[model samples]
Target: MNKKILFVDDEENVLSSFKRNLRREFSITTAPGGHEGLEIIKNQGPFAVVVSDMQMPKMKGSEFLAEVKKISPDSSRILLTGYANIENAIDAVNHGSIFRFLTKPCSNEALISALHEAIRQNQLLTGEKELLEKTLKNSINVLTEILGMVNPAAFGRANRVKRYVNQIARLLKLNNIWKLDMAAMLSQIGFVTLPNHILEKVYHQEELSAKERNMLAEHPEIGAQLIKQIPRLEDVSQIIRNQNTDFSEHQKISTPLAPVQKFIVLSSQILKVVLGFDEMIFRGISKPSAMSILKRDKSKYNPKVVDLLEHVQISEKERMQKTLALAQLKSNMLTNQNIISLQGKMLVAKDTELTDPLIQRLKSYDVSVGVQQPIKIFV
Candidate 1:
């Protein structure tokens, strides 16, 4: 793909001249001023390089480039102006994250060379970010998969809570949701330290001894410690640590959170509510009764998150339900009810999305031990 370049100047003639000079050599877009440049950055951004005149009316190039850095941090920024000074250069470099500063009346060859260098820098930055994210995601997935095998009850809760996390995130129109999803998946990783019998007791809602209760209560902190070892997972770890925290305690002790941190906390709260509901359902309580119990303690959760949780539940109920034979099941179809074996063990959890490997496993089970037929699924 051709690298995209944006040029912003208050002077129409300067912008026109840039288009004339560089349009043939690059994919050039021009904006009249900083405000228009910001608009383009929002609506049609991800540009390889953004060049802005330093002294535009209303908003300066430094401020415009700073906003661009927030919106598209990988986009290389350049400041071009006749009023170049040490102060302006410092501000542009520090605040605008500028890759290059050019004086007015710059030659075509110099500007072209700068643009080429800016594009290279943008590509390197974006490539590194993508690789880091991919590697982190794969590592998290492997850890969660191992946890799932070791303690299905705990990891199953993670899987179920992840569905609610995604739903609530979409309801709130949040971005970079994979972090929240990762937090949810690894929220119960600390349970790996406990014995399977202890987890089983917790899953079944059996009464616990004082020691067991203390250990159980420590799981969130333990999970946080384990996750914090991974780079770029500090926020995720903090979210896990706060999963069981009361809002009042959070308010008292925690530092002011960033938007992403706030979202992580919100996701953690939603997971608590959903996990409670899941436990109640496992104990044969009705969904409405479980939800009512959760709402009665309103101070424990953010009201907006609770409202969105309710909305998610309502939306889930409205999904198309069908009963199909094992041979008819397809990928991405969610289980509407738990699939149980003749021995009464749950083979698949409710709301679990079927995949090709899982389908094949179920087929093998059907042939070997015989699974219950006419499985219920949500379309």
Candidate 2:
């Protein structure tokens, strides 16, 4: 579609004249005065440029343009004045969001050129906004994939912790869900520098020396710095930075916190539990003994967070609901491997043999599988 331009003038004759001259260049729309221009903008917005007369009857052009800036910020603003009032011109430029000022009786060539430039600027800003969104989404996906593949144990711990964290957020009524989820997922990215032996020890709740304890403390700051370089991951980086702060030292914070930060922080506690439980469960310990082991470490986690997990662990109904909602499955439908949810569910096509980990997960959950489209999931 041709670019839309809204031109406002007090005189009908002036409006008609401008349209007659420039109608071929753009899809032109005209209004008799400032109020009419605002009405037109509200009804059909997103004009490439809004050109208004500086001295109108009821509303002066500067005031009108300022209001237009509030309503449609992306639209380039231009002022049409017969004689420049220096103060009004300055206000138009600074406060009114003016892009260009044109004298009355401007040549068609000059007017066209200015409008074209305004249009180009608008397109550039739009393109930049879209490119940022695409880049952010791609980066998050790549990082999540790498995190899962690099350390399955860590990934599993993060997911469990996210559940506990989300429970806290819901109780507290926090709004930054996505940020919290991301921070929780990659909360351990900094640990990539550590030896696997130390990580395994941590998972088993082994005693650590002073130096080893110091090394573990460094992971949050290390991970935060690693992610801070990526613009879109800025919020997640902050979450990593804050996740390990002692609750006794928690302070009144002013910056807007996204949901993801809490998710990450809460997940850290949950990771401790899951790893401990996993060590036991993997070693063929009884389920009752594993629960007793978790009980022993009550002091290691926030009491409220631990209580929430106990509730979460017992609520199989809630788990099934959450899993079904996340999987986006029909009541009797099977999810293809490709349709895995953000919460992470494993799906296997009946034609393919299930891998060891995938098969273990399926049987553990005792999922109801029905025939569906095939999707190969490598990780």
Candidate 3:
């Protein structure tokens, strides 16, 4: 599409002559005054270039261009003035944010060349902004997709954890909710460093050798050190660093990292209970059985995190039993409920049987019904 240019001047002959000269090269629009130009700007936005005469009845070119700077920043601005008004034109160019200043009676060659360059600059800025945004979005998505592979069972748990963290943030009444989102996405980055054997053993509640457990525990430091180099990912990395810290005085006892690092601390504390609940369910552990284990002897979990996790597990069981019972599932099916995942798609079922080889094959891509969708609220 041809680039659009808006020209503003109060003089009838000047507007008519400029439009006649530039009409064929650009999709041109002319306005008689500053107010009319602003109205045109509101009606047809995002023009590539805007050129205004320096002297006008109500507004000077600098003031008009300054206003344009706010209203349509992407549109390149230019000033046109008599040679005697060179000082004013210079101020407009510097402070008024005009792209170029031209003396009145500009030759056709000079005017056309300036307009082309100004439009090219506008296109470059817009393109750069779009590319940066796309890259950021893609990086964040990679964080989530990787999580799905590491633990298919925790997909629902992580979502629920984020919601609770959001609530806690609201409870804390902190400004800058964006930090919360960044922390939530990045807190699990360290899990990538965990050995798959330890990850599976942890999920299945298998007793890990001391060495294996220690290796698993080191993911936070490994992930943090690995991600610290990323400029935008630093906030996420900080959260990963503190994910294993206890809630009580973890923030105070440890020398605080950065303000952005606090999000990491908060997010780390949030994920523990949710991850616990998810790992138990995915391993086919029963609610009463899980609750009994939590109550047995001395548990390693923080008291608050444990209480919250147990509450969530009990509440989920009560809700699911009621919902599934209403559906009238057969007893045998309910006893051996199975989930099938093909690629990234989820299929929840009751007692669907498959060979051990098939399960292993699907697990290779980290496929499972429980991975893509995460549970959030209790209900």
Candidate 4:
């Protein structure tokens, strides 16, 4: 409901006249030219409507409005020009995405009407954006919840990798990183398709058969296929698909790419590095040793992302291991030793983070067939 209006023109009298006439009807701000207008937009902007004179010194309205769109896409733009510049105004409307244009000598009433319509358009755009964000969040929540229930190990691994990705993103000072976060969280979604026994073997670092290894290799593709079905997640899917790809593969793209394409490549590289690092940790590799190993395989990982690992502070609390009874276990605690049943089978893998579903499953197994206790835990 931000009905704030910004008027950009080179003439001082026109700006003064706009404030004099429209001050009572709207929240108005004026800038002398495109440069000043841009500064205003950056500092005190997201104005509901931005009206600019089509012919201005140094920067044309079309150029100014185009920059405004990049800075504040929700702000509806309007071009004001003389009748002689009608063609240019039309071009601006098409290219600059101006909401509308007003010819010279426009009546005050006509200007007011355009302002109202522009405000309405802004509201619609903002409302739609909010709705889409809410929907996307809810969708991701549902998917993660399902993953937690279907495959607790994979779900826990995804959450852990997401934390690492967040740490790396923070170290890099990345902006607007929700897409990267989403890619991290859903990177292992393909595990949902694999049998629980296969996942257990993978988590336990047990030797895999040729078939099992092949199945595991196909996971990224399966995950990508499942995720690409969702709207607006094509980039995320691509990131997931490439999460296992080597850094050398990303370097193969010699041609220039769009900004989004570059972001996807960077995101995939981050996921790849984090996933590999997490695997080493899960296998009982020390942080320093894991980093050294990653450094040794220079072509396998993005060195920049791997370098950020040195800064990520591993929690000291997770290292203090203790033994607890099966009944005493709680969520979020890391398992220091594999939980084995009385029958000599591994119930849970070492280094696995406990989730609610995992805890419930262990409790149920303990009841049906006793689990050896006390279980070793990080807490």
Candidate 5:
């Protein structure tokens, strides 16, 4: 497919000339002024290149291209000026990071060459971004799989907490949901270093000695350290580190946090609320009673997050539920009853949120030990 290019100028004739000259060579879009060009870039963009005239009214070319750099950094920019002074060239190059600075009445051949080069640069930028994202996703999956195998109880809690985190995120209209989701999934990774009996006792709501409790308290930091080793996961690691921290403690800190850090703090608080509630359910407490207990210590959580969790939980209960064969189980269904193996071992706890990985693990268990039919799940 031909790469899309946008041309911006105050002069209607110049825009028309650009369209007439480059319409066949590329997918050409023209804007009469900088404001319209910006709007087009926002609404119909990811354009491979944006060419703007420097002398446009209302907004100058350098200023417009600077905004373009903020909104679409990978889209190569070019500044075309009829009066090309050294100052204009410097501003265009420094502020807009323009790939090319050309004089007005630029030859068609020069413009075409610049556009093609810009397209090549855009391809490189987008290609690297895609590859990095894919690699990160694959690495996360592999790590989570290892965690599940090594510590199913902690892994199950992670899955449950992730569901609540997602609901709270949606209710808050958050943009960085993947960070929240990943933080939830890997929040318990630190527990892998502890003995299996400690994890089992914790999962069963058994009391621990002071030393063991202190060791458990350090799991978040351990998890953060483990996750921080991965590239581009610094924010996620921070969220995991702070999952047990009270929101008020964060506010008491002297240094103000960045926007993303504030998000991590909020996400951490939400995870704490959900994990607390899940613990209550595991101990056989009724949902209403558990909610009341959580509400009594409202200062421990973000009020908005707790309220959203209640709302999401209520709405989720209204979904249709079914009892199906193990072979019919699907991802994203909540377990209505504990799935026990033939040997009377709990395969998955009630109220646990199902995921594809968990489902695949169950299938493997079936192949190895054979599962009974008719698993109860809430869709």
Candidate 6:
């Protein structure tokens, strides 16, 4: 229940009057001009509502509120003007996305009602955004967990690539990273469609049949289609779909991409480089050698993204390898070696993180029969 409100006007007396009248009922801040108002918004903003005068000097209320929409989009805007006309009203709505348009000499009761309504509107918008983020995050977690269960090799690569993507995204100072993170986690979801033998051969750098090569090439699109079915994941899907696209194609994209387009392209570029680096590491190449190989092909990777790899510091704690008994295993521990049963069956693959369900299932299997002891793991 944010009761914060900002009022913008050219006249000092009008601002003073608003604070004097509404001070007891609402948390109020006032600015005497649009420039000062914008400063306030940049420094101490995200107010529940913003109200402005249309006839203000230098900057009109419609213009000020329009800027407010860009800086603090969640704030509900109201155009309170004395010289209200149909054109002014239309301009305010079109530019500011105004929540309410009320002329001056408005009754105190009407003003209070409009402010309250505006606050409610802001609340609804904020709540909806929060809900969507939560739903999408939960969905991502479930999908990744399922991938880990279905294909540990793919899941392990995805987890490693996610770490690399986070490093590059942070180095670049990206504001929102959930989409990139999502793209990294689900990038190999299409691998589930391929057989384990094919994945093994690819990992070992063995020659693949033309059919196998085509199937591997189609995995990105397969993963993208699977993800596109989920609402609000279209950008992530697009990134995954373009993960294998050459950087030369990205360069050919005309200058000044739209924000959405830029996000997808940049994220896809990061994924492409990280995926390649991971593959080289998997094939037993040293970090410097793998990076050098990637850098030699300038058109294959984004220079900026590839350069960030030099700065990325892999945490020793995450890579600490140890061997423990099945009884000592805990949830969230990464397996460094495959868990084999006494009967020579592979119980779990290397690089799979243990979950509660997985732990319980293993315990049941051990009790029912027997599993190899001293399981190799990373704490």
Maximum-TM-score candidate:
6
- Can you rank all candidates by TM-score, best first? 6, 1, 5, 4, 3, 2
- TM-score per prediction, in order, is 0.80, 0.45, 0.46, 0.77, 0.77, 0.83
Root-mean-square deviation of Cα positions for candidate 1 versus the true structure, in angstroms: 3.8
lDDT of 6 at 301: 93
What is residue 141's positional error in candidate 3, in angstroms? 2.0
lDDT agreement of model 4 with the native: 0.87
lDDT tens string, model 5, 1-379?
3299999998888889999988998999999889999999988978999998888789988999999987788898998876646588677798778888888679999989988888998898889977987898788878877776777677777777777788888888776688888998899899889987788788777899999999999999999999999989998998899888876786677888776667777888888888787778667788878777877786676666666656556324666889998888888787877777787777776666676877888899989996766887888
Cα lDDT, all candidates: 0.79, 0.64, 0.63, 0.87, 0.82, 0.86
Give the per-residue lDDT of model 6 (tens digit) for 49-101.
99998888899889899889877899999998665375887778987789989
Lowest lDDT 10-mer window, candidate 5? Answer: 308-317
Total clashes in model 6, counting residue pairs 3 or more apart in sequence or in different chains: 0
Which is the better candidate, 1 or 3, if ranked by lDDT? 1
Each prediction's number of clashing residue pairs? 0, 8, 3, 0, 0, 0
**Model 2, C-alpha of 32: deviation from truth (Å):** 3.8
In model 6, which range of ten residues has the least summed lDDT? 311-320
lDDT of 2 by residue, 301-320 (tens): 45554444444341222322
lDDT score, candidate 1: 0.79
Clashing pairs in 2: 176-258, 176-259, 177-259, 179-260, 180-259, 180-260, 180-261, 181-260
lDDT, residue 181, candidate 3: 56
lDDT of model 3, residue 165? 56
TM-score of 2: 0.45
In Å, residue 14's CA in model 5 sits off its true spot by: 5.4
Compare candidates 4 and 6 on TM-score and give the better one: 6
How does candidate 4 fare on TM-score? 0.77
Candidate 4, residues 19-76, lDDT tens digits: the string is 9999999999999999999999988978999999988989999999999988789999
TM-score of 1: 0.80
Most accurate candidate by lDDT: 4
* C-alpha positional error of residue 172 in candidate 5 after TM-score superposition, expressed in Å: 4.2
RMSD of 3: 12.0
